[model samples]
Target: MAKMPVYLTTPIYYVNDRPHIGHAYTSLATDVLARFKRLDGHEVFFLTGTDEHGQKVEKAAKDAGEDPQAFTDRVSQAFRELTATMGFSNDDFIRTTEPRHKAACVALWQALAGKGEIYLGDYEGWYAVRDEAFYGPDELTERDGVKYAPSGAPVEWVREPSYFFRLSKWLPELLRRYDLPEGHPDRIDIQPESRRNEVRAFIQQGLKDFAERPEKLDLSVSRTSFTWGVKVPGDEAHVMYVWLDALTNYITAAGYPDTAHPRWRFWPADVHFVGKDIVRFHTIYWPAFLMAAGLPVPRRVFAHGWWTNEGQKISKSLGNVIDPVALVEEFGLDPVRYFLLREVPFGNDGDFSRKALVHRLNGELADALGNLANRTLSLIQRNCEGRLPAEAVRDASDAALFASLDTLLATVRNQLDQQQFHLALESVFASVRDANGYITQQAPWALKKTDLVRMAAVLRHLHTALRAYATVLQPFMPATMAALLDQLGVPADARDFGALATPLPEGTPLPPPAPLFRKLDLPA
Candidate 1:
């Protein structure tokens, strides 16, 4: 059967802030999904980029004493550079300021206007410029006679002429699409069931207002107060609201307006991986905008939680934000990636601490996985020549060691499908633990002294186990796993899931083994 194309995206991050752990976490998760899809033989397009336009960008440009375009260019490049710095394989990095995005946003505005879903209106509400969102009075917290958003950003009353979308008009349709027949081909999937329920409850309460009449909120889609965004179509005085323009980046990546463009083949994204704070935007506002433009909504919007540092909220004020680049520099990129996903459940908030990272590095990656590979390769080189030895199944103990590799591929594939990255990795490293223990009991080195036949059989089984381990671990620890696979003498193209099913050819010449993960010797 032909594999269906898998299209996934991370929210285009705000350029006003430097890329940090939150940014890295989302992109890393998205990268893992994309890599797994490619390994599973699916056509994949992974989109990530900067949300470069907003009142915030304008202010930031002024603060930097640079042109808005120059400011956006510098900051957006930081985000684009993050993909390389973090070892991500994202296919496209889009900026809202790009001409392609501008055209796409304009096309969407025209579509909504032509459908009579847009209207000129005055927006009178508290706006959180940090979030690029308008919030109702109830959503704000009163403290010290000041109002702050749930995210703790200060909010201010802003009344301006804006373009509004009839967002509430599509609520019923959004609700209808929420629950379809199980496994229905066209059904939209929202992951982590908790988020879907939350959004559903919010919309249902709003629907009570519509129970008296069709609900229409006149959503502000454009703002006259900002000059950094795409100009509202035919209304040069106003710029498109950052949310509308940023959300349109998804369709822009899909070749919107130019619907015939080949890039449009990946329309209606398979998933939009976003932070929990923005679930309302990606799930509610984004879909309503698409529906207004007569376009298909994305299939899934999976919201993930945040990261805290030592039980404190990750904040610029506290100087507690974790810099992913620094983490990669201090530790190997692959180890940091492995630790983040492995340390926490995918949907839950994670805590970052130097101690925890080092523990996982030394324990999980270094001891369990890294030591096992190094030990096996060293024994094979020392005991049985430098080439892989043919096995003779003379002892029951020889086969017990390779048993862990038997169901690993299927187990990992199902976990990845469910987005249980930590579980998937835990399963692999669990086998690694078992393999380490198995080797200790079998004592391949001792077997060499007594029975060379059993020793060769044990070594071959060890090599086979490592091959499976390396192949499945590629998505999480690509660089380290690639080096490990290289040491195992597996050919480049053949390093994939299919190769996992096949046995490593006996007598394959192996490269000298080296430590896969180095221990961190932190200073006291």
Candidate 2:
């Protein structure tokens, strides 16, 4: 049988800066969805990459005594390396400067221009090079004799010839899509209820028609102030705006210019995972661009909140940025991955602290889950001569514990579909806690002395429960789950979602038990 296709994407990271925890958070969220869908038997295309071209890169290169492309290559490679260091399974990494991407961007621009949705124009506004965004007079603040954006990036006055998209023409259609019934094919969902309302509110604020002075609302589609981007199709006098170039990365990766290419079949991406700060870009501008080009706006745009270090916003100036590399090195990748997803709800802001991470690692992972695996394997080895029981001999207590796990696969599947990562993990931990309590109360050791058959049954139940827990946790904590499965004598081939429902073969010889999540000793 053919599997369904699921296309997932993360916002391309801007190489104007180094990758940080916020970048990791977005990739981690997308990676979880990709892994879950693949395990669920879907053919998945997961894309993540770098937005490497901009005036920022050119100036940064000039400052650093390097060419613009060379500087971008260095920073983009750093972003790619972060994916491997953070243990992500992204299928492809793209750069805006890539030749294929340049062709794709030019193709998209020509299509929109051909449709009469774009026109050459002039723009004058307060621009933030760092943000690559324009602001109105009221939008800038005078900070100690300098005008700055709300985000603190410095703004400069610019008047230049440019290209503008006919954004307002489709405003009514965009608004109506939001009002569609849930799951309607044409409905484009903006997730986390609050963000959907936020985007709608921003749209209602005001949209400048092309007939108007063309100031506050019409987006400048091509920037004449900068040439470090994809060139406009016939008029190479200006470059396509950086955001447009960056956004086209999604279609470019899906083989846009070659519309009939196999990868395009995964279009109308199932979801686009983005940070809350950029919700407006994903929900508004990107969708408008796609609709104008006659492409599908992604099915859903989910914007997740940021992380702060102990109540203060993470910033390079603050010197308080969480080093993803250090976090994984200090604590193993699985524990770090588990902490990021489990510490907070999927869409809310989270605060990271050393104390909190160590607590989750030692208390929940080491004590609860890892302990379950170690104790279960140890019991079977010592009591059953290193061979699993022929079959699980069930009692009311054993059956009850197993029953808690009966709905787990379905529950996690639902949670992933909704992108509720924390809840999905929380549900898995519920069974882990249940198994812990069952083992303590059943007293398998006491049964060993009093009733040999009952003792074997109790150990078997514990073993089965641990295997189930490991199976569902694979998407979140890949390394830890693989280690747990190895200790349980489960073969690599039998460690998939389908195999989770099958019982372990009787008398399977297990390797000696080892701790899957060793207790961490983080300094206070």
TM-score on alpha carbons, each prediction: 0.96, 0.97
| RMSD of each candidate relative to the true structure | 1.8, 1.8
lDDT for each residue of candidate 1 in 1-524, tens digit (9 for 90 to 100): 87888889999999886899999999999999899889878899999999989899899999999999999899888888889988899999898888999999899989999999998878888998888888767678988998999888899999888878898788877787778765664455677799889888878877875577653455788888867889987889999888899999999998888889887888889889999998988888888898878898888888888999978998888998888998899998998899889889988888888888889999888888889999999998887678998845546765555566788888888898788899999889888887888889989899888988878888787888888889888989999999999999899988878666666677889989999999997435
Candidate 1 local lDDT, residue 290: 85
Which candidate gets the maximum lDDT versus the true structure?
2
lDDT by candidate, in order shown: 0.86, 0.88
What's the distance in Å from true for residue 455, model 2? 1.6
Candidate 1 residue pairs in backbone clash? none
Q: What is the lDDT of residue 349 in candidate 1?
A: 87
